[model samples]
Target: MKKAGVTPHIVHVSTAYVAGARKGVVPERSLDHDARWRTELAAARAARESVEWDSRRPAVLRRLLAEARKDHGKSGPQSTSAAAEERRKEWVENQLIEYGRLRAQSVGWPDVYTFTKALGERVAEETLIGVMPLSVVRPAIVESSLKHPYPGWIDGFKMADPLILAYGRGILPEFPGLPDGALDIIPVDIVVNATLAVAAAPPPVDEPAYYHVGSGARNPLTFRGIHESVREYFTEHPMPDGGRGQIKVPEWTFPGARRVERQLRTGEKVLSVAQKLLLSAPATKRTRHWQDDLTRQQDKVDFLRKYADLYGVYTEAEVVYTDNKLLALHRSLPADRVEDHGFDAAVVDWHHYLQEVHYPAVTATMRKATVGRRTSNSALPPLKRSANGGDVVAVFDLEGTIVASNVIETYLLARLCDLPRSGWPGELADLVRKLPRYLAAERRDRGEFLRTFMRRYAGADEAGLARIVHDRLGDALLRRSHPEAIRQVRKHRAAGHRTVLITGTVDVLVQPIAGLFDEVVASRLHVRDGRYSGFLESPPLVGEARAAWLRRYAENAGALLTESYAYGDSYSDRPLLEAVGHPIAVNPDPHLYRHARSRRWPVAQWKAYTLPVGDAFLETVP
Candidate 1:
């Protein structure tokens, strides 16, 4: 520090990647890439505020929320507001990384890591050129060890380790790299020795020393060479995949980055289409497994995309670093210490190191954490009477559980299915316009959406609406009902355990299935003189209110809340599910599924059914 007064000799350990995007020979010295460090700093400092402003935009917020909860099988948000905040942070962080890369490349660098490090060097030199005696040690890719700290001791994956692991695990089928390009790998021990030598023998203050501690100059390793070594290692000692036999390693064609990325994009597009079709189809055991596999395939593609972006610059770059200074430093060591503490990389064997030490350490840490804790989809939780036998109840959420149809669909079926197809367009258009408001309210509290949307029924004849539900909506509800879910409801009833339906849909829509459960709890619309008042007579039974209502019901009925069972399909039903002894996710929405998986709770998909043409009414509802 400048303020320390006794300004200590400084040894800045920078990466050889500082030679970013530069080709041919790289000398251990300052580069002249015309980057405006001060300007870049100002722009980077203002990014968070800019991102905060962007997060508040309605469209961005909505998209991020959807991504956090429901875009493919990504782990859903833990809580709604918390999920929004978490997604906002992730979005902001990603934007910053992207922006950093753009600015870095604008000044002729590869990525954010190299760009910032270069800028930092410039800032340090400008501030402390004459104030401190400085020496810079630039290491290339630091791998496990050559002969220090015992041969194969490594904790986590380095930059190149992921590619190796992915290849071994059969996740990365192919990779792009220049076969003859210099991959300037240096053993961790060599880098350490080189740094210590520079620190011990500090350069003169005015003439700061620079050392390239890498293998590129003395003994260069090619991308093709490393690939062969990896292939051989994996082929001889194959990696196991669960209980399945050892995975086969695919051969690399050394395809260019453009080709690899193009193939990945095509694969991604196909998977996206498949996912959309699967979501639309009925939820069956086979379909659910296919969806899971799709999610994993998409993840593999994402992993390849990520590593290619992060590590490609190193592997594909043609530059060979000249490390004459480090070699000279190594030679100057005492005769006895030269063999032990030598910083030279020329004597090291890449084949022996990777095959014997590094690969084994990396693979040992890749075991799945969720392996023993998984509950099979086909296995149901044991059904038993509570200590207080009669108190045991099964609670099922209405939408996507007992019935795939939601509030909007049930209401629309009663309100508009009888109307001419020409009139349907106008009604749907009106619904579309108000959909955002309803969704926002629903996100805040399920009861709010029900309360606000139910206002549409005001002044309608209550008896007439009942007639509409009885004549049309009942059949629609049954048509969309999940067969296994209905079976569970009846199973609970037969066992003498109270079965309850807790929903945000109005009681009128629920009346059709009233006989299925012993108790029906739904939003009750107020009626004045046989005409609808368009307001809730009581607080809607959803979310935490529903949980509290169940508690009271259990207490009054001499039942135990802990002895009951709850099945839900929405994140809003989390509170209700948490109130029971057994909580099952029945074709759960993303957020609920994520929660359920984390807790190792039982998850099941109730087989969904297709209804007539107009029955896909709730598809666009939030």
Candidate 2:
């Protein structure tokens, strides 16, 4: 438009990655052509190699190294030891070459996504934007809009998707950034609007105009805020089917280098002793050499702090520069358009966008795209209770509460008994009888138990067992559900309460049951190729996890924590029960029952096996 007899003004949408690399107070037109970035990238590569090669290194050590490399060249020791530092640089170069080859073979792009973008920015600066009346708009991570147009219309995979997916999957259990780190995010609509306005506005003749359209300047939403908003939204809407629900955003700190340094120092001391002992043994000498190599690799990992500090400084600086540029541009824009077009950052309602628009859109999309599923009739009994005057939250315990038997022990026994079909129950009984002896002798020897059980019962196919659970045992399982428990839940809902069921059962087993309640919160099982990996797919809903889920739920529902009620039968539910105002113990195990009584919490007993309501109730609740 600008070139077609128009002003030919260009608005270059840049990334916060470049802007974040700045140090201290940066000038308005500062570009990312500094030497420090290359050094930091090299350090990061070195760190990645160390993590991949060092088998003996702790996970935390690998993470710290990775983080250090990402934030390289900011504020930390550049070199702890000269030899170690040299090794890191060499390794980084080798890795970069390897990455280049891989990129050529695969996507014809660089191995690192961030590096590719940085290169693109460099090219843009040198060729296109440099000569034109252009404005570079650097957005940190484009997330769901806070307001304007619509909320939660995210079009790209950046921090929001990865963060949410990781948290939901429990891959990221903690935040790994500085407390003050600006989480640069822009809504898609806001970005579009800003880009349009910038294009329409006249650009400065001296330099290519740059606008950092993100939360860092105009809206200034922190990492904490993003985390909290997500938590709150998920809590209220929840995953309709199953899997782990609301997760707490872990704490963050700036002194990640110090934390890593302390760990490395302690680890090196231990490895040194082990290395000496291995070298002394004649048969272990080869292993000792390998260990030495691994140690050297770890040392390289430790040396990554220099790069991390450097990058951190650059990133911080760029953010400052981008913020200043964005502010200046906002100031220069027409007052009417800034107001009418909703381009004024000061007037932007972040809370409204986040809570009202973005969250609802995200929730709806998740429900339709991912969690939508038809509930099986055998999965859960119909809801007998209607919500009444107040909102209600239902909490269900897994194991004996949902399924007729404990899943782990049953699977173990199924393998050991070699019990096929009719014989499975008998074999299970036999295993239970001998469980005490096995426990005394093996003491939680899971590997041995699984191997032995599999050897015995390997002939029975998984399909057959699933079919039995869905058909024969399913009805029995529902019948076994406590009537008193159902009644209590219904009573609360009849009083206009929002009911939720929280459990530690895997989604395959839990999703069907989720249809029984307004929402279901359960433990997640990792599945690959439609089969259970016998591992938790995400963090279990226990202790602090339960409380966190409750908090998210309250935030989403816009309800008071004090007005909520929680019910469970296990000792693990203590944290959850205490989190809400009303705590109810349902068919509590002896220990939990006693504890609940001691705390003056109400206790209710349910008849061990039977759905109190019919299918009609289920239809009514929905």
The number of the candidate with the highest lDDT is 1
Candidate 2, poorest ten consecutive residues by summed lDDT: 71-80
Runs of candidate 1 exceeding 4 Å displacement: 1-7, 47-51, 54-91, 367-536, 543-566, 570-583, 587-601, 605-622
Model 2 lDDT tens row, 100-197: 54542243222244445555565665665445676767665676765455446666554455445433323332333454555555677667777776
lDDT to native, each model: 0.77, 0.52
Q: Give the Cα error of residue 579 in candidate 1, in Å.
A: 9.3
What ranges in model 2 sit over 4 Å off?
A: 1-7, 20-22, 32-118, 128-131, 168-171, 202-206, 232-319, 331-335, 368-622
The lDDT, on a scale of 0 to 1, for candidate 1 is 0.77
Q: Pick the candidate with the highest TM-score.
A: 1
Q: In model 1, state the lDDT of residue 621.
A: 21
